[model samples]
Target: MLSVRSAAVRAQCPSCGTWSSRVQSSYRRTASDLPLSGRAASLAERVRRFHCDGAQRTRRIFAERHGEEILAPFARRTGRLEIVVHHLGLALGGGPGAGFARRLQVPVSNDTLIRVVRRRATAKAYAPPRAVGIDDFAFRRNCRYGTIVVDLENRGS
Candidate 1:
């Protein structure tokens, strides 16, 4: 296990975007990180909660926000580790990715990998098709027919 902590004494409010240093409380959050020395690693982070004194805002208290590139809010893994999992799931698929991760000293389940892939797929933005092509195919020599639509620009069907 690797211990870590945010060095910033102040954090910006997610609602009112005000920087605050008055700490109301602190807590520790543990998350999975990249492997170290060919072994799975975890990060124990010391997180701080601040009292949002913004009188105009509805939120009276909020947790400190870390850099998105470093660690996402309420995430179970570090950003870099999540990126590795994402690529592994995308390239090798769920079961294979999970197996490969185990070999690399990364602890992950096949279902988790599948979920990561699904999340990534939903998050990605696809460009609108500029042109499309349609065709009909027979599955059983005229007994069953199906229609197929293809994006001409992206070459996706």
Candidate 2:
């Protein structure tokens, strides 16, 4: 049983970016949260599904946008928690990151940690550079070669 529960109301649909007062349905979402006082915490988020206004949107219904700082759709952990876990995964390897999460009372596996890191990394937006530097290097013993493209503005690949 969840100790804490609440309902969220949103006048806007994130998908279609339109307002809809007609609630299609609602559901409870269990989001793992940061541990409190050495005990694991979670939230029974009563998420509302709103009927999208007819604006040529593909999705007829869209779930209410929850606190973006808290979590996202289909996310198990809070956004802040995921950020910390991602940092841990970046600092440590997969196996070590898993072990660290266990100690932190965040039940995350090695595979989950890897996924977190990959997701956050890909979610970032990099500004397009005016010019890019391209270089070629042999990847294998005179067999395979790979091209390295570096952004001149950010010096990132």
TM-score each candidate: 0.77, 0.68
lDDT of candidate 1 vs native? 0.87
Please report, in order, the local distance difference test score of every candidate based on alpha carbons.
Answer: 0.87, 0.78
Best by TM-score: 1
**Per-residue lDDT of candidate 1, residues 24-129 (tens digit):** 9989988999999998999887889898878677787889867756678888998889989988998899999999999998899999998988987787678888
Clash pairs, candidate 2, are none
lDDT of 2 by residue, 5-24 (tens): 33534467666678888898
